[model samples]
Target chain A: MRHFVFSLFTLLLACGAQAELRVFATVPEWAALARELGGDRVKVYSATSAFQDPHRIEAKPSLLAQARQANLVVAAGAELEVGWLPLVLRDSGNAAIQPGRPGYFEAAACVDRLEVPSVVDRAHGDVHAAGNPHIHLDPHRVQKVAEALAARLAEVDAPNAATYQANLKAFSGKWQAAIARWEREGAPLKGVGVLVHHASFTYLTHWLGMKELGTLEPKPGIEPTSGQLSGLLARQQAAPARMVLRTAYNPEGPSQWIAGKSGTPAVLLPYTVGGTPAAKDLVGLFDDTLQRLLQAVR
Target chain B: MQKRIAMAAMLAATFGAQAADHSELAAIRAQIDDMKRAYEQRIAALEQKLAQAESRPAAKPAPATVQSERTDSRRPAAGPASGFNPEVSLILQGQYKNMKDVPERGITGFWPAGGHDHGEGAIEGISKRGFSVDHTELVLAANIDPYWRGQAIIAAIDGTAEVEEAWFQSLGLGHGIGLKGGRFRSGIGYLNEQHPHMWDFADAPLMYRALFGNHGSYTNDGVQLKWLAPTDTFIELGAEMGRGANFPGTDRNKNGSGAAAVFAHVGGEVGVSNSWRAGVSYLTTQAKSRAAHFAGTVDDEVEGLFDGRSQNFIADLVWKWAPNGNPKYQNFKFQTEYFQRREKGDLTCATPEGAAATVACDGMLSAYRTRQSGWYAQGVYQFTPNWRAGLRYEQLDSGRRDFGDNAAYLVVDSYRPKKASAMIDYSWSEFSRVRLQYAQDKSMFGITDNQVTVQYIMSLGAHGAHKF
Candidate 1:
């Protein structure tokens, strides 16, 4: 009888805990943005961390558990999580958060995507047919996504619409100012050349007007062979880039290898909101990234 | 007015003299026009050629430029979906196994232990002592539309291919109801549905081997329905009905519908990094004359036929912890499962007619009753980004056995089998891993086998996510 009472008590507690809107975000950057918009109205969970590669993750039971109760699901859905997110959503068994619902949001859908392949072929390696999903790196794009997401949060939770709108207004003002400041401070890197670990920083470079030298992995998902590395090295030597750029989640060995060979400044940029110690929020994310790029140029 | 008239008259006189000059001027004008037309045509042709060349590289370098986006600010989207290409993937596995000895061919006094025989060339978990290609799996999966998705897995072992799993699941079944039909792995225990490619260690647990051979009693040819409760806290109830063709079952079901199972699971999170889930499942099957062949040394082999009803119960629990729910650098997972099986049936034992028989029983029928139970517990720690270590312990108990009149004639040993295993693996990335595992197996009555295995699993192309 006591065991039954204890079990009933715990079950009630669980039910009470789940009354708040539960949001499951695929990556941390979106989680941060959602938190800023939803405030205390929603409990946010991120499936992947800043340190983990977003392309692949084990769809663990905990993630499914979180998603099963989620009121909203957010993802950078240009096949960035093609490996796992679809499966996770399907298994979550939550009808409200399924695709095409107001409770579901794909940030990539709102952005004018970059790199839409004109032709169809798999020889180029793993490519997103919906274009690049790494739009969070650009402050301007992130601001647009934030606005859309805030509206989404409001629509999902009608009672919190005012709070969501207020949050968006404050965020937009602060973010636009930060972008202007970053542009002014980062003017010197406009025409500077760079090598990168992957195309993760494409939006960042596009925003800054950096001259792209090349990539270690010329194919998006394939590892660079020795011959490919040597070719990259030759190109870098002939026309030296000022910096070798990589994300916090990328492997350090390959980027450092060529950086060491070419004496280029190796820059590890915080790719997301929580990617680095200083990058604790959306504003700090851009500040830390611009600062890192400036250090590399210097 | 007089000066204008004088100038007009002079112009006319000059014109009369220069009429031939005017014709020559007309000829020159025509020539200049022709030359201009010719040059314009040539320039147009060259411009077309230049455009063609430039467009060729643009079409080809769309992917290259996306990668080289370090400088240029061109945002290129990778076109639209070209029809549908099913996600195709290939998994290759190979292993080298070393055991203290060949080990006993037949398990001592284990019931319903059919389908455990390793083929002539099989090597990884239960086969031989030398190097061998374990198995290669080809998988194809895709969404049929918004309402359904399908997947097929084919495994090739020893140069022969067999269909492993082929199923279609409903996509738009609302209200947390998911329906699937066709051949699929049963969602009974936590690991039952997981393929060998995703196993933590080099081999399966001893309980699995003794219960339903190397492959657990997982794959079923039938339909399943699952319902995730409308409430929170992750409660799911599932049930299955299958054609009784697999072990613990046989092909003797003339009317079919020989097996059925039901399961329920609940999970919750404790903090930022800790989560746990527990479940209970039950499976029941009716068998008629299920055939089992036990290999004995030097032609003492025997074949047994079982006819009976089998009931199995499983309880599983899994716990996971990572510092902040990201297992990139470090994480820990502990999983354990207990299973109890009950079977009451009649067995017909027979010996080969030709060679040398230890004790000749051409064909003898006996009424039998047997009960068995087993459990396995394992823990894995991801010490670093690329390295992991795991330990597993397993034990199986042959509870009780009764053979009516043939009890004295039958050679059955009363023994419990137990084993312990430890392994460490390194993963280069998500697609490849190499694992080294060691085990001390004591399944036979009086002999113990110390085993070592080095295995490699490589995945190429796309394999859909195996669910949590």
Candidate 2:
């Protein structure tokens, strides 16, 4: 009888193995941020990996299935998935993580937005009309997102409230320190030359105080035509934007061509977390990207 | 001696039981009892010496039962705990097509060239050409939650439109019956219902072109009614209406109409495994076209247009024969669809044949009768998860089928109309497309022509629907 009771107790103990906090992130960097804030208490999952393009993802049945099961969802919002994500969430029918819910967190909302346009136009291809949505590159912005996320997580899991608060406190300190270092190191980038795809790098340029050199793509979503490339080539010959900045996911052909023709150095930045091997996580992304650019300029 | 040893064993057992309850106080008590017990021989010796020298009454000791009773109240209660959940996923879609002179055109205003006349006179050709945002779209979706979902879609003809999807759903609706109204595409037909990000071409099938006019898988206007049917296998039915936008010399027909469609689908494989769906739709418009004449440059030549009605029926069938029970055979699948449409009356015309040299002719009739149908058979073989090759053959015609044109526009046009087309295309994901198509077009006005179109499309997940 004693052995029987002991076995039942053991079964109950097995059933009580600690539950984990569910965290869903749009990119690897967001997932990494959640992990740093959550530590051992949370489990993180990312929708986009380093190898894929964040801008053109397909919402599949399997993805809806995933969204249906998430506890908290974090994304880079502001018209990024204007065409697709709405359909996915509508299809998933998951009520808890829907926008405006306690579990929903848009990274853009946590940061000070840049490149906000005065007008919205569709003639030049798909324009955010709102501005650039990628905010993970800015440490200050990421810290803000982390703080908001921590507060949200605490609302539901008050039992671990102190742990989450402590984690955020430590994370923000490290984040601010990194920002100060990067701002100083990236000082040389002020007034540096740059050519980019779309207005994707407007936030980065504004943050770094770089010169507004323009872009290689003719319009927001258009591929550069030969004429457009030639126009850019001519401009480069006269003014010479020294760095042709391309994200790892953006097509390299046009940037490479412009670089070859104009003799500008093409720098592939980790546009989002997991865009490069060195940027394996959120913090690692900003570190490696800043270090690479600083070294190149030096 | 045996009694003493038994008492010692009893003391050890009592202390062991105490350890099972309150260890903090029990540990201290156990140490005191053990020391007292250990020094019993010395205490007895000292007591005997004391008795020999002098005597005093021994102090009474407390009962052992009191210690045993205190163990029950000190056990720890279980800690309160909760839980968390995570969602993760990936979706990919790609296609290839053959475009041979199947000149993709837009839906123009009621042109006398495309419509037929049953006598009377002719309505002159009003419009030159049609335009459409037709292309093959590929969509890749990875969503983890309401706040974090990524969509990457690309298409050949129109390029790509990708966006971050983060919105709240199920805001209202307590009862089973409720609205799923939001910024979502309304349910239309078999192909339109499926994302182009998951399609088989850089262009839609020919039948889709014939029915929807210029807006393929037409979108706009919002709000939908979703009904949950009582069934074992997931069954849902929805209906929606949207405002159609127009461009150019045509009036901005913002007086949009309402469209309602019904779908019945069953999923779950059997035998060779098949997914079969059939849907019917009827779209009616109260929208009126701005009255105008076909003359190159006419002054105030306004005409009153008709309010029209179009109805469609579609049946789709997909058969899967997997290899070694592998489901990835979506890369190796055979599918086909047959679509039919019947359209009638949206305008009135003065029948010149019935008039005694004019001067007394009001509009003779208010409607036209037209029937059209088309079908296509397509097959796809996916070589890799990211790469797929597909082939499709489709034909469409606008003719006097079972229903002949009896309207004044057809009568005035003196129309003899027929159009035959064949389309083939190869697509690569949503980002690129190379299409070739050919069409033989003959109108009621004795104008015969052939058109061939070869086009290339590339997209950068900018803003586009998924390619199915």
Using all chains and alpha carbons, the TM-scores for the candidates as numbered come to: 0.76, 0.51
> Mind listing the fnat for each candidate?
0.22, 0.03
Model 2 chain A: worst 10 consecutive residues (lDDT sum): A112-121
In model 1, the Cα lDDT at residue B226 comes to 92
Report the C-alpha lDDT of model 1 over B1-468, residue by residue, as the tens digit.
999999999999898779978899999999999998677546544543443233211112222222222211112122344336887889999888887654344456675344434333223333567787866899998778767789999988765788999999876776778899999999898888888888998877777766666565468899999988755477889999999577777666376588899999888677757778899999888877676554443235666667898888999999988766656668899999999988888877766344465445446788878888889999999987679999999988878877665555555567888889999999866678999999988877777888899999988875567666
Compute the lDDT of residue B305 as modeled in candidate 1.
67
lDDT of 2 by residue, B49-92 (tens): 43223211111121121112111111111001101222222232
Alpha-carbon deviation at A212 in model 2, angstroms: 3.5
The Cα error of candidate 1 at residue A256, in Å, is 8.4
Worst 10 residues of 1 chain A by lDDT: A113-122
Give fnat (model 2): 0.03
Please report the candidate that would top lDDT against the real structure: 1
Candidate 1 DockQ, CA atoms: 0.18
Global lDDT of each candidate: 0.76, 0.52
